[model samples]
Target: MEESDTTKYVIHAHISAEGVVERPDVVGAVFGQTEGLLGADLDLRELQKTGRIGRIEVNITSKYGKSSGNILIPSSLDKVETSILAAALETIDRVGPCISKISVTKIEDVRSSKRQQIIERAKHILTAMFDETVPESQELTEAVKSAVRVEEVTFIDNLPAGPDVLDSDAIIVVEGRADVLNLLRAGIKNAIAVEGTNVPQLVAELSKKKTVTVFTDSDRGGDLILKELLQVADVDYIARPPEGKSVEDLTQKEIIKALRSKVPVEQVVEVPQRRRNKQQMQQQEAARAEQNGKHEAQQREYQREYQRPERPERERGETPRRKSLRRMEERQERREPPKEQEQQPEARKPEPREAGEFAEIMKDLAGTLSAKLLDANKNVLQKVAVRDLANVLKETNGEVKSVVFDGVITQRMLDIAAEKNLEYLVGVKMGSIVKQPANVKVITTE
Candidate 1:
């Protein structure tokens, strides 16, 4: 046979995996090992460009026979052909739980033809390989007509530009011209239609070549399209709107939302089976019952323990106003001593202020301190200290905002702030210091 007329160039190899299928890692390894033999560059771009190396197809079968797929290589390159076959044979012997079946398929040698015919045939094979079902005459003719009518856009041909062309975060794979138009209307341009099960060789290459998300409709036809894609394409995400919804059926808003909510590839591959409402409710009840039992056990444990008496309140470490008043009383008492026996300064204390007024005072003080604020509820900043405020701001690189206090700020607050070198302390109310640590902004005002 003339080199151009040789029809025995395609080699077919079936590889069976030990479990569900060969791990992607193994598949990649096999590809890597045989890259020299197949005459393929094997990089994503080249794999996409050449579609098939020769007539050789590497078929993968799962141990359970539950899943299978194929990889193709062109056979025209003699060196690649020999290397591919040898590598396939070697891999069959060495890989885990995998057996390789090798064979060859004949194709009409159409070499020496015009460039356009060669391109057309190559494109046809890709679409055919990825398509789950070949359309009968009527559907086939219609698809061709639709594709022919498609308008071209920059970096795209025959598809409209409704999807923002610049967005590269996600990709959409669909079927046919009408579908592409619909997606465009929905303002989803990150999409490419297969134009039939015969996804163009270019589309097939792109699917494997890009970080893609597949979004087909919820019908058998759509399912077929997706199957074809999953079989031959490397997709990272899958998105589906409500059942009975097609990409064409979605409004622009719906399209954007659906694309944003694309499910991860693993989720798509292993869709969670739905449980009945009754079963779900039962599971919830069991969880609640377990929680209740734990709570009751905790309560019983608490009841078994004895509580300790609280210490007597002291004046020196009391509220600031109380501390000042107590000091004055102490002076008077010391001056009179035993003569003022009935006047125990502690017993003749001023009336206590309401919690609200105390909170207001702390808030005012916090405002004056001008520290970076953290989360505050009821005016108490969580995990913040006056001494650390300045440092925290500096560490955050000056993103700190004003700090406010609406709860009792204690001596511990001052200690922590000082330790951390934060600036500004604001409190809803102040307590008498065991000792006011030096050089910390401690403000307690309304």
Candidate 2:
């Protein structure tokens, strides 16, 4: 066999004959019987000549005038061809004598077994290589340098602050302790956190001594903190993360970019004041226009109420005009009943028992941290993890009558429920949902 034909399959067969048979007879019968079975492409004669099939070996023993032995054939053919060749060997009925029987027992793929051995050897080699290597001097030096640069975190006035706050000429004020660590990682060692929305007194005092740059998140909460900081401290400059990002989450490059883009406190205060003044003017104009409309409506109402002539004193001779007005009033009274009837409210019907039952079940499930979907008859269609509730809600169609989950009811969840025309969402808490759909009722346990 050539080197390329090293990976071949081994076919094992059992052969038996009633008359005594020798090894050569068994081999000859196998070759002659399966020669034309699978056509020329897989013919055992042509395949053996081309080195695609290896030598066939036979071992036989004779006892009591009966012969039985094993037959082995190796083939470099692919799986389908190997299987066909193995099956054809079973058709050899008479091998050089009385009725013979052959059965192909197994066909083993040699390459798969070799591949497993190679994988185990490769793993061993890699592990040995890793174990033999030691850390170089340069790697040790880099490790030491990194350790030195890890600044120690300390507390100042009960707020987390970096080690270089006292020594540095300028300080960066951030929203939380994580922001302080991030800035430190970025090589800005003079960062400190106010810990919360409220500015600490020590931070205000530090602002008076050092050049303080207030770095906050780029959200509404950040703006509120900035306003409070301005009221309580003498801030020099203001920095903010990119829109929709938090200070703690900014990358080193982003942190540097934000710091470079810092604006003077004067500009920050003036722009917001201008915006506030503009908003106040718009509100005042809107209020004035509304008041004017109300005044016009009231004037029209007064005219309608007082323009009618009072009954002329009976002492004076009743004028023809007064008699005509009195008849008109009597006709108007007859037309008012239909309008009053239209204004009366219709009676309300009782709610479905299923909905009430579902609500009760949901109330009992509060704080369970699981989600359940209900059908029209209040049967639970599915129960799922609360974290997967949003995705499940998106894929479900209108068959869902209500969704009860032990999680916060967010606006996104509410919107999806509304799209499916879902009637009720009972949860443990509610998020800030600005625009609630009128068709969906949101209920919270707390």
Candidate 3:
């Protein structure tokens, strides 16, 4: 028999006989009848000789001329070959002069069973080893303490808040849930989050009862949120994270320092007012400068108009009413030889027809909320909704020479027009444009 270590499959069979049958008879019948039943590769005698099949064992009991027993065979062959060998054992019809029947009950893969046992044992070994290497008393205690502190986080009116927010005399309002958690970690148990730029009603109501400290990030968004809260909520103090930093990223020491240096709400509120006043002053100065420029332009235009030389009066004979007048005028000119027939100032040149055409087109588009693109010949290229004007212009590839829209001319529209090198832009109103290009003429209805 081969050792169990080399065996891969175990086949179990039940045997029965009508009359008494011994164990040796059953074993011999199994080997003899099943011999050559399969091919030479699966022959029981050959397989056993090559150590592919293990020894066959038979156990029996007899009672009143009837016998029943079991047969066991182990194989190193694959499952299909093992199953074929086990089936062949059922062909043993007679065991030493007694009619017998054999049936294979089960075929077990030995390695699968061993693998399950190995996995369970490995789990036990790893668990014990891990337990031995765990943190010591103080380290474990601190870990538990930190976990408890984090668990103290609660919610107030759908906003992340600490467990003691309602009971605390002072409350710290932060930007988001992460900031709230960071404050909690630092032992500040009266913190809450507005969650975003919008100030919540609960926060506003709490501010009326408790002293509120608005702690925010140091970015533009934080400043905007602070302004929003100040307008709606009764904030008492304001604390800001370090420049270019966020409340959620601040360490405990940094958080404490910022809180300690917080300014009163009145001081923070005055900062924006002072900024607005400065901006208004600058705007007033710019308005004066622009007015001066327009006044100078008007003066230059008047000077040019009046400085032109006037046309000399014609003599009597030069009058177009009669040939006699012409003859008389020529005679007088011959007599005096008027100093260089003073060149008549050229008739003031008429306004370009294209400007009139553009005006008519803009008048038609007055309340239509539509735009027209014109080519160099004053022919309409395409008309589109004012909202789609910018996109259409971008696609025109400089084909459009002018744009007339019944909408506000915004800086964005101006930028697009400049890129396309448009000649003229006409709209109902003009937006706050910080800069204007000299090449493109911008006109408004009012």
Quality of model 3 by C-alpha lDDT = 0.77
lDDT on C-alpha atoms for all candidate structures:
0.51, 0.75, 0.77
Tell me the lDDT of model 1 at 245. Answer: 56
Best by lDDT: 3
Q: Give Cα distance to truth, residue 345, candidate 3, Å.
A: 65
Candidate 2: minimum summed lDDT over ten consecutive residues — where? 341-350
Per-residue CA lDDT of candidate 2, range 321-373, in tens?
Answer: 56656655775587646333233221122256534665676676654446899
Candidate 1 lDDT for residue 63: 43
Off by over 4 Å in 3: 1-149, 271-446
Model 1 RMSD to the real structure? 28.6
Q: Report the lDDT of model 3 for residue 381.
A: 88
When sorted by lDDT, best at the front, the candidate numbers are: 3, 2, 1
**What tens-digit string does per-residue lDDT give for candidate 3 at 164-241?**
899999999998888888988888888999988889999988987888899988665676888788777777788887
Instruction: For model 3, give the RMSD to the true fold.
Output: 29.8
lDDT of 1: 0.51
